[model samples]
Target: MADDPILRLRGVHTHIGPYHILHGVDLDVPRGGVTMLLGRNGAGKTTTLRTIMGLWRAGQGSVHFDGRDITRLATPAIAQAGIAYVPENMSVFSDLTVAENMRLAARSGAIDEQRLDWVFRMFPALKIFWHQRAGVLSGGQKQMLSVARAIIEPRQLLIVDEPTKGLAPSIIQNMISVFCELKQTAVSILLVEQNFHMARSVGDTVAVMDDGRVVHAGTMADLAGDEALQQRLLGLSLAAHQ
Candidate 1:
């Protein structure tokens, strides 16, 4: 239902060794829309994504996805539940060809031709470099390959961290176009991004975290229109960031 959240985190706390990261993070990712997670550096944004992927175990609270509790589930099990994660590093196998890296990401051990065609439509560079080694591709092409791998199989949720971190302006624009197209597919996206332009353009919902807690949550339009709120929560206006 549109009223129900696809993913929910309630009073979630996470610890990395002795250092506590997420302090009672209460968040909701609505079904079939992009929910952009924004905050200043060290605001626990990345940790939050890691926690959701089971890279960091939540010390307290619950993570609910598709109406099931997944707080303590193993990483592979959590992934099996239909959540695909694309970390900041764009973890593509450098030594392998783009096709090989994509083939590995398929849980079924075989690529779906129709899905592959769809992905190519989103990122033509991947199709152009199908047989090329990942290490030889430029930064933007590598990022596209990484995303291609994630979407090679059907997924209910896609979580990405700083996908535009080091890309050039043109590449960022391409990514924006691709994400806009992905949004039309109706797959929920929990994106951790510092690029305010990308966030404003693609985010349907916005959540601002500060000091390990969600300090603000609302429609992206609301946040985008309020320069004062943006400054207070993010320490700068989106316009300034852009």
Candidate 2:
């Protein structure tokens, strides 16, 4: 069904040790486009992504992906169900070569030549550093490699946490281009981003979280065009960032 959400969270609550991070977060990530999750610091945006990936278990409520209940699934099981997650740290193997890191990401332990070629085309720097140690790459290149590993093979959903954090504007623009291109492939994306420029550039739908709950949900264009709403939800206008 074209209108069905690729991922859905209903009345979700998450507790990280003594503190409860999410309070009944209800979000729907519609298939085939980037859904940007935006909020101020301490909004539980990252916690929501972690909970969805099974890194943190929901204390209450349920999560559904592809119309199936996945609230209780393990992290690996959630990943095996055609989802890929790129965390904020860009966790590439420091001691391994770029090629080796990518190979490890492949479920079959064999890199698909065609897919590898596509990734190289999207991020030419990866090809340049194919044999270089991942630890030696620059911060931007490491971020690219993290994304490359996630998409080394096909996936139904790609969840990225602040891919542009600490990156230069030029590098962030490049990452945005890759994400825009990825949108054309009909793979659903759930992105938690503070970079308003990157969010507005790649997002089709937008959800704004505040104090562990989603306070706004609508098309990105609507929020982008309404400065007052942006100020009210995110504390600053998207225009100010542009």
Index of the highest-lDDT prediction? 2
lDDT of each: 0.92, 0.94
**What is the RMSD, in Å, between candidate 1 and the native fold over all Cα?**
1.2
Model 2, span 1-242: residue lDDT tens: 13689999999999999999999999999999999999999999999999999999999999999999999999999999999999999889999999999999999999999989989988999999999999999999999999999999899999999999999999999999999999999689999998898999999999999999999999999999999998899889888887
Could you list the CA RMSD of all candidates, in the order they appear? 1.2, 1.2
Instruction: Give candidate 2's whole-model lDDT.
Output: 0.94
Per-prediction TM-score, please? 0.97, 0.98
List the candidate 2 regions with Cα displacement exceeding 4 Å: 1-3
Q: Per-prediction count of colliding residue pairs?
A: 0, 0
Pairs with steric clashes in candidate 1:
none
lDDT of 1 by residue, 93-155 (tens): 999999999999999889999999999988999899899999999988989988888889989
